[model samples]
Target: MQQRAAITLALASLLAIGLSGCGASEAVETSPTSTSGQGSTTYPLTIDNCGTQTVVTAPPQRVVSLDQDSTEILLSLGLADHLVGTASWTDPVLDSLAAANSGVPRLSDNAPSYEVVLGTDPDFVTASFGRHFAQGGVASRERFAETGIGSYLSPTDCDNGISINGGGTRTHALTIDALYEEITELGAIFDVPDRAATLIDGLKTRAAAATEGVDFAGATVAFWFADTKTPYMAGGLSAAGLLAKTVDLDNVFSSSPEDWPATTWEAVADRDPHVLVLGDLQRDRFPGDRLDDKISFLESDPLTQTIDAVRNKRYIVLHGAELNPSIRFVDGLEKIQSWLREHKDEL
Candidate 1:
């Protein structure tokens, strides 16, 4: 989970607005309307994005991406021309994403201040996290609306109607369907319905190929994102969990309520996963979140070393970006299955 004051404020705002965090809207089953085969653009699009009503009167010409996942989406749809700025936070510069939008200016190394974002004169802003619109962050959704600037959040970050254990909303479970819905929705807003459809079809094919003939019935996996200080675990409702399901590996933390929850080392020890998937975060940007550090702890700690996975050194290093709710989710799934096939005996 993202431990930040901004998220706390966002949850409080949701409650203040009488949004009960218990359910989610149905997935978008149809592609947005388009002037197919004509090459002409369609517009005046209106979408209910993360419970916020967003209307784009025309294609957004100057877009600002506040997250890597959103940046990848814009580029994947051949909408790089519309992006005027992009930001980087947890993930490093992905070669494919960087090459797609070669000269697009980077507005910030991380989430930019509201002033810096406004300096770019963006007509639209897209983010993967809901806290991007917090009061002390980019202000609020209404504030952006007042300025005639449209904003969008990834549905996986939305909890408007989804309920959780402690009277708050857990991060919406990330899945392949959620990724497709986001791409399709963005396509409609940008007048590129056909492109979105084509992309989704390709992604679906990739996903299918990744899971074909894979049998992971007896294996159990744990996606460890952070350290023992307050070990951040990827719960069953997360993208990682969904990928585990696709590969047939049981997620050890599937019972946790939060998508990314602070877990106890003792609990992890008890579960004793068969494989440990390490999230290789950028240490410079995220100080202590190094993959090596986690490995060392698992191997050296007396208690942790006793676990079967630790003793066997069965670890899979995953780029943090691949694990996020993004287009690369399929790629992540493929990697996991391929690894399992190569090391089937480990199970």
Candidate 2:
């Protein structure tokens, strides 16, 4: 309780500082959700996305998404016809979206170069992480604008102050509302506001159904995203935290402010989480990216082997994208809810 109180206070202080600008109007209010309407978007739409004003002259007919999350969202909106190219994938495309996704071109299995993206003659671009617009990314928003192309960075990245250096940090806990806002804004940008509204409504319904009559209150849990030597555990202000909170599961590392903090196995073992939510990432970027590798390490490592979760083999595995702030987050939430219901007696 003391740790949670401190995190609350820290978030309050950050909010106060952000709103205490020279003038209230000058301050950018980072609401958890967007206020975009459900009406169709008019031509020459200007969206204030992540502190940058992106002006779309018309519905983008040739869009290039820099990440899998953004690409999936676009496909969900039935805009695959408009998506000319995509890159930076971590998992296979969602089965429901496979047919639509097949029609689009994969720019690269990873981050594509600026020239390569532009080669598709794209009029608009979208990314799920700030790193895509950073120094090593395809190009900055300013550079895209300079080339007469509009771009959007997911609000989750900028609104939460996620650093481009690593997994980044968050001052406040994130929720599904952020994903709703992204869908709404994207719908408007693509002149498909109704589609966005429908998507948000469906997600809300699914989330409600997932949590209905489910309560795992007081059951401490931990989310291990990747890495074995220095594991990136989920903190309070992330989608994993949201999943834990929704199911009333107490996140062991909720006190940390970083979205995915690199912590020692000793720290995780000390907390001794009752359940372990492992990310089954398909990416081969790191040593522990695979689910089998993660399980092998947990059962073999002396420090982790004795942990309550490892000893009991209480684990819930989710796809890589589900751990990140995106439409797939609901998938993670539902899976966790189901697991808790099935293992109620065991826990």
Candidate 3:
């Protein structure tokens, strides 16, 4: 209770630093997803993913995606026809992925066994996290290559030269740029560069429009990814961090190096964020984790009840699909920006 009270006090002390002159009225612009979009891409394209250099001799006809983010990406690129099998994370919110996956063979609810994945006869596979390709995981890149299967991992999970599991030690911050790059790369690999370019353009336009009138510079934001004894926070380098920054909010956990850090209630109390951004995950996995439950925690807790944002009922919710690195990143940004617009007075 004392911890919650301290959080409320800290937030009360910071409320006077109002967010003014923080929003950029002019459309904030970013470079195109990739530089290779200028000219036609030649076949047999080889690119380094994670730590492996994969050469695509031709467009893969049968694909198996090991994660929701990868499956959603394939769906967004109109590659549903190419997907022969999939192993999705539980209860992904993307409508198109769900619809496209209806007829697709379920390799597994989570990561499928090596023999099971191989049984799907997939020519290509993609996973959002590098851990999927690690030892004792779905399968290693070498094993896939031995079977003439190509694999790709989302850049967000890759490090540089230093190997961690099946990924590198490169700690590139997950941002819209990375999302665009993934889309563009997949398009080129699938022989649909034009489609990828069009999709990226549309995404950028929507993102720009979402921020038109919203200034978020000084707003302290906290992303509660889970409801455990210790809260899970989105690190400054992850996709959630990028979303927070997109709206110009100062992420309380932005300084943490880990992509998702587990910290105590005292830490959250210290930050006393102005707005709480909750990442809504699947109910099956987190039965008691709901937006209402979190809100209740804030409203009922003696210490937390005094927090300015909680006292005033300022909260924003983002689905897991929207919070992860994938085609829906722009959509997530737009949603949060819209929410902030609705609660502009709180800022």
List model 1 lDDT by residue over 1-347, tens digit each: 00111111121211122111110111123343333323334334456666576666667778899888888777777777778888865666556556656777888867788888889888888887766776456557677677777887777666663223213456545556667677767766677655666667667677777788888885888888876667888898877887777777788999875767888788889999999888888744532378878888888888889887898888877878777777777667777877877888877
Which lDDT tens digits does candidate 3 get at residues 1-347?
00000110111212122221111111112233333333345545666665577777667778899987777666766677788888856445365345655777778777789899888888888888777788768888778888888888776565563333353433666657666667667777776665566666667677778778777867898888776567777878777888877778888999875666788767887788898887666654553256667776778777767666676777888776666776666667777877876888767
For residues 1-347, what per-residue lDDT tens digits would candidate 2 score against the true structure? Answer: 00000111111211121111111001112222222332345545666666676556567778899999999888887777788999988788888888879999999988999999999988888998888788877888778877777787887776534442224557667767677778778867766655666676667767777789888868999999999989999998777888888888899999987778899999999999999999998888888999999999999999999899999999999988998888887787788878877899888
TM-score, one value per model: 0.83, 0.86, 0.81
Supply candidate 3's per-residue lDDT for 2.
6
The most accurate candidate by TM-score is 2
Which ranges of candidate 3 are over 4 A from the true structure? 1-41, 90-93, 96-98, 161-172, 286-289, 300-307
User: Residue 98 CA error for candidate 2 (Å)?
Assistant: 0.4
Ranking 1 against 2 by TM-score, winner? 2
**What stretches of model 2 exceed 4 Å from their correct place?**
1-39, 160-168
| lDDT of candidates 1 onward, in order | 0.69, 0.77, 0.68
Candidate 1 vs candidate 2: the lDDT winner is: 2
By lDDT, the best candidate is 2
- What is the TM-score of candidate 3? 0.81
